[model samples]
Target: MTITIDGLSIKKKEDFYANIKTELNVPEYFGNNLDALYDILTEHPDRLQIKFLHYDRMCAQLGVPFCQKLLKVLQDADILTIINQH
Candidate 1:
């Protein structure tokens, strides 16, 4: 299933990670960190379609490094594609 995250609305790192945890149904043991997020996405059993809306806004809020990390995670996962809408 495809999951869309409203990147524009996410202004805080805490909120962004929290939303990821909820939307991805990450386990309780899941660490709320970029590394953990990467692990979850890479190991996810189901085919995931991740779409980021208003990606520019997200980048502006989260900074380039965070966005870069996310992109790398998605790239490594292979099963998911990032459809970033400008």
Candidate 2:
């Protein structure tokens, strides 16, 4: 799957952060700060499937439409495809 920002998929920040961490065999990103996470995302926009457990809830509280920023699927041949807004 693909995340699009203005048809570019750049606005989905949280999703990208999670994808890279997971792909790199690092621990799942867990923090209370979205701004910090957003900053991290700015560094890598190619990765998909990031952790946004807190951001989702906050978006719900703020009446913001939080789309599926992070997603992962095991396709054929053990392929792990992480999709984020990009």
Candidate 3:
């Protein structure tokens, strides 16, 4: 089953993005495979720390490894995560 970052069905994604954007000082991008995209978020130490804190504090967040897991299962993964999203 493919999942989307927005598909998490939380109170609101705007809240999540707000925190991540504030924490990293960068705008967060939304995509179907949020798990895979996590790497881009955590590639840097400062960014990773910010993201981890956001996960523990504001919401139960997932990281990049899970994204890789999902990426493997997806056939249209590129379209859903990379091309179609941007």
TM-score of 3: 0.31
From the highest TM-score down, the ranking of the candidates is 1, 3, 2
Which pairs clash (backbone N, Cα, C closer than 3 Å) in model 1?
Answer: none
Ranking by lDDT: 1, 3, 2
Across 1-86, the per-residue lDDT of candidate 2 in tens digits comes to 23322213223444444544444434355442344444444444454433333444434433343332222122211223333322
Assess the local accuracy of residue 22 in candidate 1 as a C-alpha lDDT between 0 and 100: 85
Candidate 3 residue lDDT tens string, 53-75: 22222233444454345445332
Better of 2 and 3 by TM-score: 3
Q: State residue 23's C-alpha deviation in candidate 2, in Å.
A: 9.7
Candidate 1 residue-wise lDDT, 1-86, digit = tens: 88888887789788788888888888989887878987898775788888888888888899989888888877787746665666
lDDT of 3 at 38: 58
Q: Estimate each model's TM-score.
A: 0.87, 0.24, 0.31
Top TM-score prediction, candidate number: 1
Q: Give the clashing residue pairs of candidate 2, or none.
A: 3-85, 3-86, 4-9, 5-9, 18-50, 19-49
Better of 1 and 2 by lDDT: 1
lDDT of 2 at 45: 45
In model 3, which regions exceed 4 Å deviation?
1-10, 27-37, 47-86
Worst 10 residues of 2 by lDDT: 70-79
